[model samples]
Target: GASSSVFSASSLASSLLSPFSSAVGLASSGFVSAAFSFTGDSTSFFTSSATTSACSVLGPLQHADYFGLGKLLSVRELFEARVHLGHKEGLLNDLMRPYLFGSRLGYHVIDLDKTLQHLFCALNFIAHVAYRNGIILFVTRHQQTAHMVEETARESHEFAHTRWWRPGLFTNSTAQFGTVTRLPDTVILLSTLDSVFEEHLAVKECNKLLIPTVAIMDTNCDPRLITYPIPGNDDTPAAIQLYCHLFKTAILRGKERRKKDEEAAARQQQEAAGTASDASKQPTSA
Candidate 1:
């Protein structure tokens, strides 16, 4: 049974952070994944699997990849979706070099291993948020994929911002929306930049509002600005669709869990009420 606790930020902090902090490896997470396997090198910070177990050093929180969204896409599937293809080597951001597998011809190849790790973190975080009935907002500045992104958001029952962002949308929501508007607890950024040289202003505003962000960062985009960065080819329609499918599945799973928990809680309350009435009907012992 789900614990009878409100899913507040504090309740979810461990769930969201531990996975990412596990040295960029989701295999050690104890998540039930069927289609993927993590190489021993994924946990570079630890000795080979021959030596010590990943759980030996990590806490219980790290083992709680409860959503099991990791199994949604194998490295092979990601490759098929063109998720590993990056921008030209010349446009590569120095910060994102760590996620690069190597240069292929003139283009940089993203390390699918690392992308898988970070994607696990991203999917897990959003799932927990959905479980808590938190709001999610998807953002992207890519014109070619804007319609698809918005459609994904609608299907997932979330919000999207594909058009030009209004200044003070988050910073001054009350005035901008003509009333006190509720801000999203988290934001999913398909692309962090509006153009090759210009960064999206919402990135800064989200930071100012202290909203957590999960972003698909291309080679040329800086990953440091994102809370959970999945290094991949953000511009590819196929890649974006793959991401949408995985995230939507995760969110629906979270909501399903939440509904079950609520039903269980209500049943418990009704049972308690019936017991109280039976006790009242009996002669007073006192």
Candidate 2:
């Protein structure tokens, strides 16, 4: 009877401590969650904190209605690059009035939303042209953008003119512009036509030859001349860098797609030939 009483007392003590132990476990888990909670639309659980902190270090995030250009750079990054900054309000052209976000301290700011829209449109068109194996000639007389334009053309296996554009490069026939054998299918102007007065001849020649032109039009530049005008801060080094990188990337994507298509066609032809050969080798039942 005395041993049974001692066993019952030990069982009672075990039951009394079990609730406190469960509560401690639950409290520790709650503390863990409170201390390290992951927030944000990121798939990375470990790096989200770091990313969020870095983003906050810049400042509060501005809401941007992004379409597809986010892959190139976030809207915030575009803002940081000063792509929205434009010439003084007095310098803005009437045609570019619609693209202005508003005036800031006597200077007009180009709307980034409009910039993204036009940029995506231009990039898609460029990619399509590149896919067709068209010759793209980059022309930029502006000294600041010359190196980047040349480098971009080199990387994409295209052509570029960093120096003064020779008049009649496109419009003049082989007989007139004697050593040139061919002309480019498309022209990409890094700076607007006004940047180089001599380059106006190239623009006129492009129009005469029916060659499509893509131009970066600053707030002060006229947009009516180019086939595809991208309103942006073309003079900013960061903006130009973004433009060059994106155009090169788009061309590369198009070239890769074209190569894939060519390979697929070749494979299909080979498979058809193999099937025909196999059929011919089989004996015909009379």
In angstroms, the error of model 1 at 76 is: 1.0
Span of ten consecutive residues with least summed lDDT in model 1: 42-51
Clashes of each: 0, 0
For 161-195, candidate 2 gives per-residue lDDT tens digits of: 87755666666667666776778877888876544
For model 2 the local lDDT of residue 162 reads 78
- Per-candidate TM equals 0.77, 0.72
Give the 10-residue window scoring lowest on summed lDDT in candidate 2: 28-37
Q: Go through the candidates in order and give each one's C-alpha lDDT.
A: 0.76, 0.66
> For model 2, which pairs clash?
none
| lDDT tens readout by residue for model 1, 188-216 | 99999985447788888988877888899
Give candidate 1's TM-score.
Answer: 0.77
